[model samples]
Target: MEKASSVLAALFGSREPAEAAATVTSIFVYPIKSCRGISVPQACVTSTGLDLERLQWDRQWLVVNSKGRAYTQRVEPKLALVDIELPMDAFKDNWEPTDLSYMVIKAPDMEALRIPLNKKCAAVDDISVWEWSGSALNEGNEAFEWFTKYLGKPSRLVRFNTELEIRAVDPNYAQGYKTLFTDGFPFLLASQGSLDGLNELLDEPLPINRFRPNILVDGCDPFSEDLWKELKINKLNFHGVKLCARCKVMCLFVDDTGWPWSVLSACKEMSGREVKGCCCREPLRLLAWAMEMASNAAADHGCRQPVSLVLRILPLLGTVPCQCTAPASASAAACAPLSCFIPTINQENGVTGNEPTSTLMKFRSDHALKLKKTQGKMFFGQNLVCKESLLPPRGSKTIAVGDPVFVLQKYSSNVDAPI
Candidate 1:
């Protein structure tokens, strides 16, 4: 009992047993849209999204091009390489910035850029992301030059102007909720079980960062989040608005290589599993291909890992060779090389291919939407809109890593649409 208590305390910072069906396993706040995320033990759940008190709020900042359009990993894979950091005390609710306080930004071959936390900025209108357009505060010349050199194009860093704009969630989904520079919803909730189930169908398992979920939960059945219409954590209620349709951004390589993975190819092959031992054999080939692709991409980026080391790991992965004969029961198409199905490199973005999306389409597509004659899409996570406190002094709720998640209400079936 003592040992178990120690382990629980180590993982969640509290030894209390969960009293709900699920526990919040992780909390991530992306201060800047599409940049790296900061994992926190606890965060204030605000009207917009998870926030680190006085330091930064989720998606409060954005990188924009010369035309004031947003730049995301989908357009510039190099954004994945950009890193953001803040002082440790910044996460505290009461921490006040001293004269030395700064938000440090770093990227490859670029000197660290520091922006004072208390610095004032000029508000600029014309910044836009996805379907929302509004005014935002410009971070100034230093940030401008830093991003321009890193992205190799005219770029600027802008903060969403809270005082000037109110970007509301689509009325068709959540009537009155609002968000900042997020792709759409304020909160994206994912389940560890869902990721585990998806990883079972993947060649190399992906990290939770691939989904960029703000709230990640555990101790739930795979895909159960899809049916979560309403849930609560701490003192806040979160309603599932739309089923999050994954984009190419999640397929981006999670390594320093800056190469995109073939999610389409991965999903198509791993999801099908039509051939006997396809999971075992095909994955081996896919692993080798990914390694080689990563190696080549590294070389392109002027950084290369030892190919010999990659080869050494290959033998440990499986004895399966690139050349393998399919069983009699399998179709001829099943035996074709993955490269034949799709070009190994995307000509437009230099991505190797696609996965999970192709696989997800087989089983996870919205059947209700399809029946309704609406354009159907494959979904992985749930888009959430918080039901903030109606009383005075709103956005005071805080959610922690070990907080128990209660399902207040849920759909009987995932096939049913929330709207």
Candidate 2:
């Protein structure tokens, strides 16, 4: 406790009392939905989301089916294998892409496809993502044929028509806040401390990519973003409106081959390459195993308290397991230290579950008193809506790595409150 206090004092020596003293550690922008992300040193904070204008904006493009429905990693795990890139200079402000400038896309067993950055096409109507159904700019027949061939299905690449459509965030959360093609809010912010905390419980630690956060921060305690109702970064205000609910996409195996586990066997059969190390895709059972592992960890930690209790206790201890000495009474046997046992679960190839998501549910579930009204769901990061969008003279706001983060306001009760 003394060591942590000294560290905090040193860290916050230059910050105001209201600030949490965190800093931006990383920023990522997904050019295409359910595809690989590009890490940038800085990104323009737009009303819709992160943008580089003529280069790439987060989720500005979507891959749709013949029915005009969006295809994501959920339904098509192979989309994880799709790699997209643009010129590094494109991320610079006011950088323009010439006629020859293109966004190159590559996939396993497919030729590289390059689409002009400024390419325009006739409006394709009835394209849908979640509840929003509207017209979008088609990426031409060549782009369509490429996706169809790569995905082994009828697919079309369509760009969002920002001028014609206004997709509003749910009024119940943050009124008038709009997003491009994100699941809900414009920005998702996560804490590195939270990831490290969860990683301690997993047999194999998962990367931040699994959560797909737009902004990643460090130097704060685990899950501190949950209590942050309002914050400022790079002179722009960001309001934490809701907790980010996770889905099955995080459980899918993303290998170096960029291919999902489901296609490895087929790739082996066709290409006759050695496919010995990859784990089989078990989306359903993996989630179950992750939950079971977390439950077991909690049980073996010498305490069987509810998740909310543990969360409430985390801030004081700077750790998960209780730090009390071993109990002497028979009735208090459950109060033992977590170090008493080592988890024997093998994670190399025999492991059946995904980490972080499975463990996040054990502590960040909606069953807590402060979150009970929400639907039963597992949460990780905080969904943010920039206040600049709601203010006058809205202009491009830039956030870069190492920018100081200040918490201006917070919820009265932590999400860790007991139910």
Candidate 3:
């Protein structure tokens, strides 16, 4: 196993640095937790790793369960359907974080959830996000009830509390750095060249949104980011921290109302009943076959024959254990790979169950490129931390789309990291 921090040393390999400077192609920010991100023409850069009061514009808000545990698309796949819209037009005056008052959040069948942003607002401390826990402004029961209704669970909204807390970056990677609700670092960066290279190998090409990088630069060879040690986008200086390890969250079926996870759940329920028929009949073989159909319906978008459900009802049936085998690497282990949708059974109960089944819906581009080239870890982007002084003191400084990007470091191989 790899360290909790920079696990790329065993996997990501070396590449030649591009002589040509890169261009800023796109910048995206996700104001709401696990929802769709909006591309910005320009974003105000802020210091994250330091003990700054608060960092804004990134993952400032988060969704917490009853226990205050963070919820992401990994568990709530429909989070992808929640639309997070920024108040760009409100920036007519000063472009500082204070200028923004609220963000509009909308989901399917529900009225928009509006939450105000108060930089000086007090917060509820000890909100858990993996190993590091910190303070966050509890967005109140109205926000909680709205999320609980949509997610079908006791979920609430919390914003990062800059007034009372600062999260440090992993010491293994960098020191004195802090990011909000992000998995690790403050910024995630990728290049157009890498995407083009990946698209060449995939049967279904993915948009840049699928990877969810903070900065998308043009030019450079495929996977050039793997070798970047230091960089400067316009005036902001950054240290390349680590190669990101991607999970199934990157490959989700984004829909108008989150991905139709609920719809698939309904499909499984409806199909399960059709197998049991009107006579309380259960053909042992038909029951087993029907479960397969449900799993398929949950994984694939294509509709299947309802005949599997309506199979001729037979009175003869026996309850049998349904076993789902783990991949060779995780044999007998609990979790499955990103590409798999396996159900686990408890020996004591003979009942089988699983979390919502997920498949590689987007980024069908070659995993061989992302998964193999960077190590079996599948690094899709670069995590960056910037110097505190580099950020604008007040308001916003517009960085045009075609700004020049300079690699501040000289050519060298990484000692702690892999090829």
Clashes of 2: 1
Instruction: Candidate 3: list runs displaced more than 4 Å.
Output: 1-20, 47-50, 53-55, 89-100, 119-122, 247-375, 389-398, 410-419
For TM-score, candidate 2 versus 3, the one ahead is 2
Can you write out model 3's per-residue Cα lDDT over 203-230, one digit (the tens) per residue? Answer: 5555676667778998887768867777
Q: Is candidate 1 or candidate 3 better by lDDT?
A: 1
How does each model score on lDDT?
Answer: 0.61, 0.60, 0.54
Q: In angstroms, how far off is 313's CA in candidate 3?
A: 31
List clashing residue pairs in candidate 1: 262-353, 262-354, 263-354, 263-355, 264-354, 264-355, 265-354, 267-355
Tens-place lDDT per residue, model 1, 343-375, is 112322335355655555566655523533223
RMSD to native for every prediction? 15.1, 15.5, 12.6
lDDT of 2 by residue, 153-195 (tens): 7999998887787777778887766787776677889999988
Give the range of the ten consecutive residues with the poorest summed lDDT in model 2: 309-318
